[model samples]
Target: MTQWPISDAVEEMPPGLWIRRGAPPPMFSMHRHDDVEINLVLEGQLHYLFGGEPLTIRAGEIAVFWAAQPHGLIDSRTGDMCWVHVPFSMVLSWGLPEAQTAPLLSAQPLITHAPELAARIAHTAERWGEEVGGSDPGGTADAADGPADEDGAEIALLEIQAALRRILRASSRARPEAPADGGGSVPAARLRQVSDMAQFARDHHRSALTIADVAAAVHLTPSHAMTVFRRTAGVTLGEYVTMCRVAEAQRLLLTTSMRVTEIAEAAGFGSLSSFYQHVSAACGMTPREYRRQAR
Candidate 1:
């Protein structure tokens, strides 16, 4: 076995979005960052200690997770892998349904096996690796494709998002959840309500939204709505709402010149103190510090 590298302390992942194709590195420490991380194992297998659980991602499998949770590469058979890190705030901008967003934030790795999509996914990753100057210690890029243009970066982002959606679909199909309704074949009927409640939260997070308002949007009583959402999403409705607001604040801090006070209001935080507390908890830094790190 390869010797473990360096310390095992959790380190903060630097801010930004990036794509890379390379050999898996030896990691002895668990580290975290606030981004949505996707990994495609092209050859051999990659092992990880993710969120205090041992996970093995074999070839042709793609794993997705919230990087905010401490994770590290523990072992690997000689293999090539592609990695994509999308800022958490940017993922919220995608406004994906709760069914999809919930798992990413759940601090658990979502692994899906889709051999049918492997070749295409690998091709896209190679393209991105070339375009973004991804550190390619593995030398996996196709020589014929050459380097990609600046515009390729934007296109890569869209393709990555699409790939995530596809992976989520495969995951859901693989593990069919029990319906909220007893023994009902159509889980969508109740599941749709959960999705709607999440959408409502995202759409109106900037406003003073109550459980009553979100429940009303989906036509469910507040109590029932909360129950159903927690069961399905593995998170409380209020937690999701706070997630939405924090995501918006992250986006503003990264992309705009707004002051902390203005950003707090713009992102729908009821108070500056509340905003500071949440941002620190989520990003492990103040709004100003997060922006500076990104630079």
Candidate 2:
């Protein structure tokens, strides 16, 4: 099987929620994080390789998913995307009914077809963007004064709860089936090994990593680790490492004033040539161009 990289989407943030508005990122490889994620498409379509199945969310739609499942944005024709990341703990605290939370827990993305709700979401996203001082492509929204401020945090939580309830109402007649497994139904032990390896890569992507290091982290031999990761994640361990590095590079490029060379080093690239090669291949543009367009 061909090895594809998987980016990791874990970062420290304010306790309950994180929200951002911007262009959809370049096609990301399969990855999983611990948050429950919502995507509100304002003006274009998003195509996802979600749990190994094809799903397309068009303009004027909102989709929520359990981000712990392997998923990626393989394609997007959208320039305006609003993403809200609510921690699982926060979701649990919302006291939503079983029917409302069951599908997401089971990995089924609850998509609402309410155009009015989409507009409301977009407005909330704009307010959030302003609250955080505009689009934060790197997901770090003013760490000094983020949503943790009591008033802003409370408003965001209330807005999210209302939005979710509205979605539950809209989806009553069209609830989707549980999402299919993304990793070809592997054994639980193998899944844990792969998850561990993926998390390790995410945690240490800023440093040089090797297959042997990742294998040791998961207490498996290199070859056996590779086999398990491939069978369960549909990607090789090496590719996943590269994906994490490239993703960090993209984030720095779009969100910081750091020079390209600096970003390359900070993102764990061994050489400027490799950094340029990977960035161009992933984003279809040079880092400078990407930054300029993103701004």
TM for every model, in the order presented, reads: 0.57, 0.51
Question: What TM-score does candidate 1 reach?
Answer: 0.57
Error of 1 at 39 (Å): 1.3
TM-score for predicted model 2 compared with the true structure? 0.51
- Record all residue pairs in model 1 with backbone atoms less than 3 Å apart, i.e. clashing: none
**84-202 per-residue lDDT for model 2 (tens digits):** 77766567666555455545544347787777787787777666644433223344452234544668756766877787767665776554553332433334455456656876887
**Segments in model 1 whose C-alpha atoms lie over 4 Å from true places:** 2-5, 133-150, 178-232, 236-295
Assess the local accuracy of residue 108 in candidate 1 as a C-alpha lDDT between 0 and 100: 57
Clashes of each: 0, 0
For 1-295, candidate 1 gives per-residue lDDT tens digits of 6333245455776645666666765455667776778888878888775643446899888888877655677678887787777776677667666567667645358888876675577667767666655432223433334336768767877887898878877787876882222322214556557656765786688899899999999888999999988976788999988887786676566545779999899878999999999987887888788878754
Distance (Å) between predicted and true CA of 172, model 1?
Answer: 1.4
For each candidate, C-alpha RMSD in Å? Answer: 12.1, 11.3
Q: Assess the local accuracy of residue 69 in candidate 2 as a C-alpha lDDT between 0 and 100.
A: 49
